[model samples]
Target: MYLTQGLHRSLQRHPDKPALRHVGDGDVRTHTFAELLRDTGQHAAALQARGVKAGDRVALLAPNHDRLVRALLACWWLGAVACPLNVRWSAPELAYAVSDSEASLLVVDEALAGLVRELPLPVIDFEQLAQEAQGLQALPDVRAGGDTLAAILYTGGTTGRSKGVMLSHANFWTASMTRGAELNNAPDSVSLLVAPLFHVAGLGRLVGQTLVGGTCVTMAHFKPAAVLEAIERHGISDVVVVPTMLQSLLDDPGFAPERVRSLNRIAFGAAPMPPDLLERALQAWPHAEFFQAYGLTETAGAVCINLPDNHRDPAALAQGRLNSVGRAGLGAEIQIVDESGRELPAGQVGQIIVRGPMVTRGYWRLPEASAEALRGGWLHTGDAGRMDAQGYLYIVDRLKDMIISGGENIYCAEVESVLRTHPLVSQAAVIGRPDPHWGEVVHAVLVLADGATAEQLPLPVLRDWCHERLAGYKCPRGLSHVPALPLSAAGKVLKTVLRQQLAA
Candidate 1:
């Protein structure tokens, strides 16, 4: 079945129930289940009218908004794959996804229309489409069965290249069901959606909540005040956030115990949480259940979770194993394999591999890349981890050249790609440096392009240029002018040397 079928049921069961609450531009707007259904149906009709066929790819480049969700559902209803791009990406980045997915139609909000001027694809402004949709009715059924592809989530690729992970209706449904079952979710539950809708963590939370017939209270964007306010204002029952987001909320002086006491649970993932920070959050709330989840985009965002009982146990929390991502879910198999491809014994570090119904089919249109990752029937997650005899999984380090900054993965190649574009850069190497707050920050070492000097191309100017081209977190924080970048025997930039130089 299509993923949006659950929303259809919710519309029938509680037509008048609040389905979404969004705050923007000094206004608070809401949509009842019936209204959302009507609008989405109209959107489906509009999409069909514009030649969006079953199995066609439709891409969205926008932030969190009611219209964004509506467009997604409309695409699902029409049997089109919803490909939502990261709004923070540069024009080149956005263009790469649009071209890679071979998206026939593009959807953008009013604010982002200018960014797509150079792209060759046809565009549909969502705001204008929303106006046009007001006069339409329910569209014809175009979807197929449960195995039909529903969405394409583009995740990490080698050397900062992009790879699209194809998720079927079954993949999404099973992930939501497995996570909901683990959490013991109820129909009346309410969830807070503060993460960007583009990420797997956020997408899974939204779909999981909807599957359980729960309400999602969304923020246009995450801010400390907005998060706390929504939790209090909407009586939000659940929240899925990264550790950085949780830390920011805890740092806010305006945060109150009473406001958080009403929440059922707070789920954190995407990056590891420091033990001290987790303890602080517990002391501040003392009421809500805390769960630490760990997974990748390939697993549909979750594989393991550290439950509330583990969080509250001093022994578990201190051994820091409570912070460890829990064992595999039902019907899921997790293995630790060495570099030589042999299965390692318990308590040995190796890459974590997962195989389950929730795993994605493969990367879109990239057969060789897909085969490399899906070899031996397991999704080869580039995360180094080990499992204990008791079966809990412990994440050790990233095997890939990826950095987790503020819960966002900043791949070294992606940063290097941008840095090479600089006029003053002949060569570049990007590395992560430890940050007390962000866990790690991107640092760049550059060898000047022909005639540039450190004084000629100041750090601020170089940073500003990169800020415009790359996502904020991916931009290099520290700039080092180098005489030459270290190279290996094969003539590849040696990142280890750069890291040592920075530390020294």
Candidate 2:
């Protein structure tokens, strides 16, 4: 199915309904379904005027905004692929994604417009785009469907590079439909889109809401106070958050159980949720249903979901249901398999694999990697997890040394690479350290250069240096000065030994 079909349905079903409420630092702005569609048409015409044809890739660099949403629809309306660059990434990181995607045009919000000024492609902000589309006729829908490429989302790779995960229109539709009320609620549901749309979870939620003819409340930036304000003002019925965001909201001074009483559903995932925080959350919102979803960028969205029923009873956590990522979602087949692709029996920890309509086609222009990932007709998740006899999935560990800090995936190798570039660093080994608030934070073990001493580079100094090269989340939150890293015979860092020594 086409992505814009829901917009059409909403247009016919409830033209005057509030389709979007954008909560920027300025005054809140709401858009009706008809207005949304009208704005999308104008944006589509603007793209067409710039000679953006079907199959062309358009890059968007911005936070959550109604204009960004409309621009996404505009791309789909013309059968073009929309590639949203991660806002947290540095200029070089974003440049890499844009270059890899081969985007035809770049869309930006004013705040980030300057970072991309040097790029060769045409750059236009939303305001200018709207002004340019003033009198242009609306472009007719191309009706792109099935395997037609819809988006190119960039995710960190094992090689310390970013890979563009190519998701089609069908993949998005299947994932959204299968997710259903688990993430999406009733047709009239009002969802707060606080999560950045560049990620699959956030994009999937948006599609899920659209599929059900629901209203979306966009946030230009996520602030605990702003989220509370939006929920109280709009009577938001549904929300999707990571554990970090959840704890921050609860800890925010303005947070009152009464302010968020309108919330009926809260879908959380993307990182491990601390049990203590989850327990506190359950206590805080007794009336709200909480669920956890497990998925990858390759799966478009939810592969497995721990339903709200699993979280209702306190004993469920002791019984193991609450700790699980849940059983395979509708239309998804999840299995734990060995190296030879043989499915392991229950209780056997192995690689988690998923096969379903939601699975993405492959990495953009990386056929060998694509073939390797999708071999045996199942997408290898590179995550170590186990399944119970009753079908609940428990994630044990990550096969890849990837750290999830504050809901952002930080590849250890990538962080190590950046750290190695420092003049004072002779060698570096990066690992994830469990943190109460951020799920897991990046921690490093470093070997000083020949003339450098431990006092030469402090944690604060290194953090500022790394922030210049990498995203703040990926920067090392703490570090230890070591003579040398513990290495295996294969010349790989022995992360377990480092963890053991650190713990001791």
Candidate 3:
């Protein structure tokens, strides 16, 4: 299916239907299906006027807003690829992706006009671009389908320079259908799209809602109070968030059951979901259905999702279902394979490999790296995970995050999960601290619960606590306290930064 297929259908079925809404610092804006299509067409014409053609790359650097949405649709309309740059990046980081994507034109939000230094290409303000096209000729949908490049979404460079994952129209549609089917996106649904569009989780949610002709409300930035306000004000029925975002929303001073009572679906993923935080969310939104998605930028969106039924089922929870990212969704295949590509047995932790229609073709212009990653006809996800007898996938941790301490392998997520179970620990991140004798030692960085302090748990106390739940060798040998962990745009803990902190 094409990315904008539903938009055309909606234009025919219900032209006046509300399609998008944006709430930005007291500025509220909206667009109907007809309005959305017209805006998209005009934006497409604007790009065309600037010499953008089918198959050309258009770099989009903006936060979540109506103009950003229109620009994305405009690119798709002209069969051009949209490369959304991360707003959280430094000038160098943003320039790297822009240069790598070999973008022909830069479409930017005026607010971030100064971020791209030594601007290399012709730039058009997103607002002026759309406003200029108001009465211009409406561009026809080029109908770029399977294998046609749609968007170039760069991965969050938590480790190093980010790689742009090339996804097609079919890839987005596949992810939209797969994740939406599991999340149950209805036409009447009003999704609060607060996630940064640069990330797949946020962009995928936008695609899913648009594909179903559902309305999505955008927030320029993610703020818990604004999320509650949007849910209450716009009657938002669905939302997508990471574990950290979910916790903030549940703990936000403005949060109340009634304010978000309109929410019927909540989808979370992109990072580990702490059990304690998940439990708190469940209690706060007993009326909502919860979905846990698991995938990477290469996989478009979620390849697997722990469904609402399993989330709310007592028997399933007792059976440790909450720990699962769920079985592979339709059109996707999940496998745990050893280094040699041999499939591992159930419950054996190994590299998680995925194959599916939603899988990205490869990284932009990095054939050798692409071949290595997409080796054996499967995307070798760097994540270390295992599958149970029932095909439920349990994410352990990133393979690179695994620590070898005194010749013993220790997965950080295992240690972090146990640490989060501690009553006083609100958040935990584990890393390997270089030790002269042991080579590497498990080091724990923790964020304590409200009214708690580092004084409550010293290094020895933490080691003793971990020792009770973990093997002696796996127990942390070092401990530090942080008010909050540095995170990438997608909400994954920034271990590289943590390493720098340790060195300092």
Candidate 4:
């Protein structure tokens, strides 16, 4: 059940098959399963040479690259935990992660080598490691059991400084299998890797593809035109993207049905998909099946998935099922519970809790936080949601994102949904603003669509539009038009950033 088990199987079954096709700036490199295995073995030996051992931590700071994947596989092969630092993080932030994880070895891309100059760890340039490993003998296999720690993924620091999520080999294996079964990842599947590998969604997809001996086409970073070009050139069958990336692709001048005609499925998550955006995507890629995944870093990746059939069913859409994050994924259990931790009846919004093998063991070195989150034998996902009678889950919003104004509870998603329906609104994020009278009031920051302007859709007009579809109290009292909303690398709007700006 180790994460590297799939690679072992792929090597034995399809050694000469294409395993990776990496697209970088003016460069294209392909690797067969045999070649990937040989490189991974060399990398394992190299890590051993650098003094990394079982139970040790190895940190990586780089963008999506074949070398990064090899590094991860190499760590797992040696029974060491791989800590992938966000490439978008500042030097101080990266230092904090490496320090908190107690990583003994740091691997950085040649381009980012300067960022970790002051870090107190043995550093290995990614390219240099490859060069050094070229003539090294393959290390003997070191088998890690299912319970062995495989990775420590850090969460986005919205509440405070991010905590390290300790995931085991079992967690990664179960999550990949569960998602693969639900997504129907075939051995012939050719998946495009556009999401940052540091995120669970991207890394999990990479593992799933390897598990099935499928081809993975890696992109250095997400670019709408480059993505379209790769899909056309590689005939990529499966892709995972966030809603913001989907919207960007739709807006790109190179986007057309013909360019992605080979795509079989498009899986999306990391944020709620605006219905308008979903509708536009459906129109653009009519032949491709659409899926919406819902989970957290703690769950490895997706624990629930809205299938393509659910997306295309008119009755489901009319009944609001299309808005669902879908039913629980294979081998996962989902429940909505009241504040007292009792399971609630269907349609009642409560804290969404899950119990599954895919859930991470706990946060690294944060026992108090771990106990709080993993209490009562369930992973208490700090998200407010409801399950329909048939098991569809509708994510209301983050529990913290729920706004109380004039003693009425207002879910930001409801307001954002209404705001997005307006013809002029392209993107919208709603947050709670401090108010002495009401405790807090609803505020919206929006980006207007093409050919639209703030002058054309004034605050008064926007309020009226929201009023037509929402309760008077839920209508935003304050509106600000911006060209773009602050976002995390995973494509989620940084509501914390928005709140900070409002407070200042």
Q: After superposing candidate 1, which stretches have Cα over 4 Å from the reference?
A: 141-145, 156-159, 318-320, 401-504
Alpha carbon lDDT of residue 475, candidate 2? 89
Q: What lDDT would each prediction earn against the true structure?
A: 0.80, 0.85, 0.89, 0.91
Model 3 clashing residue pairs (backbone): none
Extract clashing residue pairs from model 2.
none
- Clashes by residue pair, model 1: none
Best by lDDT: 4
lDDT value, candidate 4, whole model:
0.91
Total backbone collisions for each predicted model: 0, 0, 0, 0
Candidate 3 lDDT by residue in tens digits, 418-503:
99988899889999999998889998999999999888888888888888889988888888899999988767789999998998
- lDDT-wise, the better of 2 and 4 is 4
Spell out the clash pairs found in candidate 4. Answer: none
Point out the higher-scoring one by lDDT: 3 or 4.
4
Q: Model 3, residue 394: what's the lDDT?
A: 95
Give the CA lDDT, 0 to 100, for residue 457 in model 3. 86
Task: Sort the predicted structures by TM-score, highest score first.
Answer: 4, 3, 2, 1
lDDT of 1 by residue, 1-504 (tens): 567776778877998888877875667889888887788889988888888899999999877777888898888888999898877667888899999999989999778888888899889789877887778888855655487988898763324577899988888778787776678877788887777677787778877876666787777677788788888888888888765577668878888888777787888877556555677788887887888887777888787777788888878867767747888876678899998779999998788999998898899998998899999899999888889888899886567657888897676755775687777776677889999999999898998866788998777888898899888888888989998876422123557667778899
lDDT at 105, model 4: 95
lDDT of 1 at 396: 67
Q: lDDT per residue, candidate 2, 1-504, as tens digits?
A: 999998899999999999988986867889999988888888899998998999999999888898889899899999999998888678888888888888999999889987898988989998888888778888888889899999999984334688899999999998887788355458889999888898887788898888778999999777899899989988999888876588769879999999999999999987666666688899999999999889888998887889888898767766879889988888999999987889999998789999999998899999999999999899999988889998999986677666778887676756776787788886677888889999989999998878898888999999999999897888888889988776422123567777778777
Candidate numbers sorted by lDDT from highest down:
4, 3, 2, 1
